[model samples]
Target: MEPGATLLNSTLQQTDASVSLLWTLTLVPLSGETPRKGPATMPLFGKSHKNPADIVRTLKENMAILVKQDKKTDKASEEVSKCLVAMKEILYGTGDKEPHTETVAQLAQELYNSGLLISLVENLQVIDFEGKKDVCQIFNNILRRQIGTRSPTVEYFSSHQEVLFVLQKGYETPGSALNCGIMLRECIRHEPLAKVVLHSEHFQDFFNYVEMETFDIASDAFATFKDLLTRHKVLVAEYLEQNYDAIFDQYEKLLHSENYVTKRQSLKLLGELLLDRHNFTVMTRYISKPENLKLMMNLLRDKSPNIQFEAFHVFKVFVANPNKTQPIIDILLKNQTKLIDFLSNFQKDRSDDEQFNDEKTYLVKQIRDLKKPAS
Candidate 1:
């Protein structure tokens, strides 16, 4: 054989073997699970793995391949996605085959110890679109793993909260944003993870993300930000109270941002946080601020009816404060007649929202009856 022919044959053999290994590893059945269909599972160099730990090890190896390859070929990513799907199938059964609880539990522990989740998220930018989705599914499934009343994945992340924050950094990467945001929301659903993120110094970064130039990234981030703030009400209330001035300082900027979406979402979130009974102290403090009241009043006049409507939900809190501060009362009295006229006409098209109209009338009556602190 010619030297070039031998070289080409060697290359083809190597490629074929790599595919065989990936395929073998990809379809490798967990302990006691049924053998997968299609190509039969084979030995690696010679050793075959049937333990559930082998599944986790295989995942970590492919995940490493994704991380190490700065310039990933389509074939490489396809193999990784296949591995991810296999892992997902193990966690959630395919068709009539229910997943083996013991196998899943073993896989969950192996995944946590292997540090695969962190590696996957940190290298998510290198992954292709479809593979990113696969990673999201795999990560979310692992995140849902539980033992009795306790969630092991959530516990793992509570100490390794940086993984969630790493996911947040992806918000800046165009390919990574929505995928990262999805995993992020999943983690923060657990109170411990939410508490860590809520208290992270970078927690304020969400403010910047929600106002970015890209609509999809910004909107997805806003959704995650909303979830973190609203998912665990008690944790969120503590976060808001402990970090009130700083939290709302960033929040207040969003209420007036040139990005209309930012302004609308922040206003809506403000109404939600301020009105929740759990956040009574925080809401009381928020409504007492003359500056906050003024911001809400200005938002009331925004050209977008949606903004005006969201603003009303927040603005009414200021009006409804039974123990309104002198400054709050002064602002309401100053804008009393103007507010009545504005609320009277504001979002009038929502005639079906009897509650809104009633609230509007109530706000009108509240301001109208204000005695200006008996001064």
Candidate 2:
């Protein structure tokens, strides 16, 4: 064979071998091993051999799918459900083992970084019954997380405050209300998050939420609303002062609410606030109005003993305020006889309360001293 022919044949044969190797590489898996996804990957069997981050990551992806569709697929739902259960166990732990603190810290940080909390709450309707509970547990557990004195999770919430309002929106959805309430209640325990909720325009919605037709939801909403107004007294005082007109306007509506519970609770809360030293300014402002005095006076005669009792507690404040507005003084003087007569017989069953007996005596004298209209 000639040198040129032999060289060409050798080149062709080498090219054919290279082509065969390339085909084999593309067509076959080496040793049949699939690429490892991560520890705690789904079909999660039991506990994962990998990191909890895998659970957070998989759960986040599944949640994205769940959030986009109103009707979630069972497979995705179950997968997310499984991850939620595992997440709960990871954060709160099982009976047999405590959750590793470091692991939880890592997971909490990752969850925030991924914005999973925002997604979970905004799409809470997609999670199933038990899964919704797991979501709540997961959130509260993470919310309790703090590094040193600095609460990283609280900071995350402060930055992503929309999550807090989404929880508020949950009140309208019966399925998610209590769960959202639980989460929101926890969030507000941290001052930053509470301030965010108190200052937001959404705060107005809480008035309506507390009045919703659903008994449990309205009750839950009232609990949250009360906390917002009373939890951080200093913060609340400032908010009330800045927004007094708006706040008390809604409050007055509650005092006149057709719902018995609403009227009673509002009256009780009014007394509590007006009596609180932190709310001195608000109380003074509230009692300055003759219209407010008239409302409390009317409530003092409400049919329900409980309502009347609560109203009397508020009514005493008006008669007791030394700096009574001129309108307020006129109303007190006009009702002086009726006020003394009513207090003498008011809540007779409360005779056991020494403090109440004394206050009733004090109010009677204050009204009698109102320079009786020369009758």
The candidate maximizing lDDT is 2
CA lDDT for candidate 1:
0.81
lDDT of 2 by residue, 1-375 (tens): 246754554454446546545544534335877643332222223233247788888888788777777455676898898788767867886554588898888888778888888889988998999899889989998899878898888998888889999999999999999999999999989989999999999999988988888889999999999889889999999999999999988888898898888778878988898898999999888889889989888888889999988988888888888888889989888777887898899888988999989999999999898874456
Q: For each candidate in turn, give its C-alpha RMSD to the true structure in angstroms.
A: 9.7, 14.2
* TM-score (all chains, Cα) for each model: 0.82, 0.84
Tell me the tens digit of each residue's lDDT in model 1 across 95-164: 5558889888887777788887788899888777777888898899888877789888888888887898
> Residue 8: error of model 1 in Å?
32
Residue 49 of model 1, lDDT score: 23
